[model samples]
Target: MKKLLAAALTGAAMLATPAMAQADEGKIQFKLLGTYVMPDGEITSVNTDIVGLPAGTQTTASDNFVPTLAIEYFVSPEFSIETICCMTQHDVDAVSGLTGAELVSDGKLIPATFTAKYHLNAGDVKPYVGAGATYFWWVDAEPGADTIPLGVTRTTLSDEFGFVVQAGVDIALGDGGMGVALDAKRYFVGTTARWYAGDTLAIETEHDLDPWVLSAGVSYRF
Candidate 1:
């Protein structure tokens, strides 16, 4: 009777091992992060300069830090799909020619992005790399303080599509579905800025808005 009981206990242990391993791998994860947005807002070219912008007129966009939320779904143990939600604001100012002149103010945007990531699991540390697409949706924008003096009553930015590449790492705290996450993404995007005077378009300029996004925070999986 003791031999039979020992064999039964051994079989149960073998069955529990697989269940414990599966429990450690979660299917969904949520991350709350703080992100630093740094953008290069250099003017690539002037499409239409009705206001007679001075020669050597150059522009730049300001940087911002905001809260971000990321959701990830693991399709397999080594592959996952992820998306993030965040809204960032920026101001465009002249860096040269009319130095210190603000050209655009309070430009709010939402960068909708999706990525497919491959994770390399090395013990408790998992590193991932991904590439995906993004769409820059301009929610609101206004002419700057200086532009209002130039009969610029209204301003608009074109919504555009772009691409992004991502890399990050997740360090597991314990067997419990909690981890610390660090991520970085680089975006290649552009926009056309138009300033209007009543019903007439006054200025149109093309800008390169390549931005580097850095984030760090805690993540939970279930």
Candidate 2:
């Protein structure tokens, strides 16, 4: 991940020099976007491991395409505050290590975030990096008979804080009235789920909800 960030920064710097025609400062920019969540991350359950449910017991969230809306207020020529608006739904799945059976299927997770960005240069083509916080909520879980050993009846994931790191580039289109934006954000989210068995306290397990989100969109500046 560090290598990827370094490469992106290097590439963005190379592209920054030629597109220095400068965008308007203090303007509001809106983006209509499409996003893809890469399914390369994992969620671990030590409770399942403790119970010795299976050898390869693992949990993962599903990946899909989703729509997103983002608004950015350029505070200065090189700085902006951004908030992405969208309800992202992901299906969580747990697989049994022994029988290779799916234990929990179709559990849902949703996240929202806010970021502050620093544009590398005040140009028509802007490459920037950002840092932010995120809120993750777990909802609607379907745990099957395969998951009984974990004693999880009601699913309650602790709503907690997470950090976000992002990098993006905006390229001017036509005469610079509109543009295209390509962005990537990596979320560092880890939390514990309070599992209940029929109103009785059951288990607490760690879930690593880290995900890399990639987006592309059209941007309009005013």
Candidate 3:
């Protein structure tokens, strides 16, 4: 009887090993995604309009699609910390006052972000909600065609800090550590646009840069 009990205990241990290993494998997840960035570049207020913008001056930022990489570390079964990396380019155009005119050209930005997420598991699917902070890093920009014609030789956007709210889901493909991911985030941010003619500041405007970021792709956990 003693020998039989020992054999049963050993078999139970063997049965549990694979489950333990699988749990450990999901501590880190890496995702490759295609992201859509849409921003509202409306002029909230014009601080300095030396170039004489009209009364109904307004702007809109062009939407962009870019490749994004996300990395997540599971703090527990239901909690994770995640960060994403990507660079998106955009152009700001006048939609009202000087209709169809470009005001800022080829502005490149990197949204450096971090979030703490709470995940809920249901069968093979996990849904999550997160809130985070972001810093809009303006890497490069130039005066638009219309602005350049207006003695605008340089243009710069101020880097600012903002907050973001996110929601997403992960669908497991199989018992393997691969899955599909879909995510959406809303950002609340603002920036100051300054146009320069030689060494003189020609125009300075404040803009609301609230953007909707959407992403869909595959994820792998190891």
Best by lDDT: 1
Q: Candidate 2 residues 1-222, lDDT tens each?
A: 999999999999879855453443337999999998764325465653334444555666667788899999888777899988766555446644434444445556677789999998645678999999998765656654555666767655566689999999988786655899999999988766555678765545677778899999899887
Q: Using lDDT as the measure, name the better of candidate 2 and candidate 3.
A: 3
Q: For residues 1-222, what per-residue lDDT tens digits would candidate 3 score against the true structure?
A: 999999999999999996686486579999999999999999998888777888898999999999999999998878999999999999999999999999999999999999999998776788999999999999999899998878999999999999999999999898789999999999999999999999998889999999999999999988
Per-residue lDDT of model 1, residues 12-101, tens digit only: 999999767756678999999999999999999898877798999999999999999999999987899999999999999999999999
- Once fitted onto the true fold, the runs of candidate 2 whose alpha carbons sit more than 4 angstroms away are 1-26, 39-52, 95-100, 144-152
- Residue 75's lDDT within candidate 2 is 82
TM-score for all predictions? 0.91, 0.75, 0.91
lDDT of 2 at 157: 56
Error of 1 at 207 (Å): 0.7
**lDDT values, one for every candidate:** 0.94, 0.73, 0.94
Compare candidates 1 and 3 on lDDT and give the better one. Answer: 1
Q: After superposition, how far is residue 221 of candidate 3 from its true place, in Å?
A: 0.5
